[model samples]
Target: MEKKIKPCIDNEQILKQRFLALRDTLDLLSGKWRFCILLNLHYHQKLRFKDFFEVSEGISPKVLTSELATLEAHQLIQKKVEYTPTKDITYYVLTTHAQEIWTVLNTLIEFGLSNRQEVIRSFHSDKN
Candidate 1:
């Protein structure tokens, strides 16, 4: 059996506000690298600029820098700078705010797994 997902706030008058909330969530999670970055932080906990290469291939430094900035602006991740004896190291870590997103990601994983075959079939048929 499949689990049914429902909105937490189901009041009629607040539907407009709920849609606005959804838009805000999408704005933060919209870009290519933000979701990937969040998932990376979820697993790895802390990452340096160089570490993103392992997170996702073909992420250029310019794009990574921009995505990191957006994520930080939304409080999804934190940018930390560390000074060692000889060098300054920068790292990114998931913020407490990301815990809720982590739950959503896990739920999405399950949904994808359950729906993969039908989704693939639908895509293939659409191209025919």
Candidate 2:
């Protein structure tokens, strides 16, 4: 008979803390449009409200406004108002802190691509 080792309390606490952090991160990023909006900002560097509406496709103006407000509140993005002779143009740009998300986003993209391939393979196998 083999004796099983008990889990350490410190390890359990660390795991719990990690899970809580993950939950907090998900809470902040939760929503279809947030990731899309962030990705657009990453690529474009800066964009106006109308630009988001055009690029994000399928997102309503109301929801975009809300999401942008949330991101701004969280300090993930900055809202810049450019005063001009004609009018004030509002542009959204990512904060320096937002750069931290690049690694997470890239990892998610790789995982998604791998998962899609696996799902396609499984579907094909089931058909046969």
Best candidate, lDDT-wise?
2
lDDT (Cα, 0-100) at 18 in candidate 2: 86
Weakest 10 consecutive residues of candidate 2 by summed lDDT = 4-13
Where does model 2 exceed 4 Å of error?
1-11
Per-residue C-alpha lDDT of model 2 across residues 47-74, encoded as one tens digit per residue: 9999997889899999999999999999
TM-score, one value per model? 0.80, 0.86
Model 1 stretches astray by more than 4 angstroms: 1-12, 119-128
Clashes of each: 0, 0
Provide the overall lDDT of each model, using Cα atoms, as 2-decimal numbers. 0.89, 0.94
Note the residue pairs that clash in candidate 1.
none
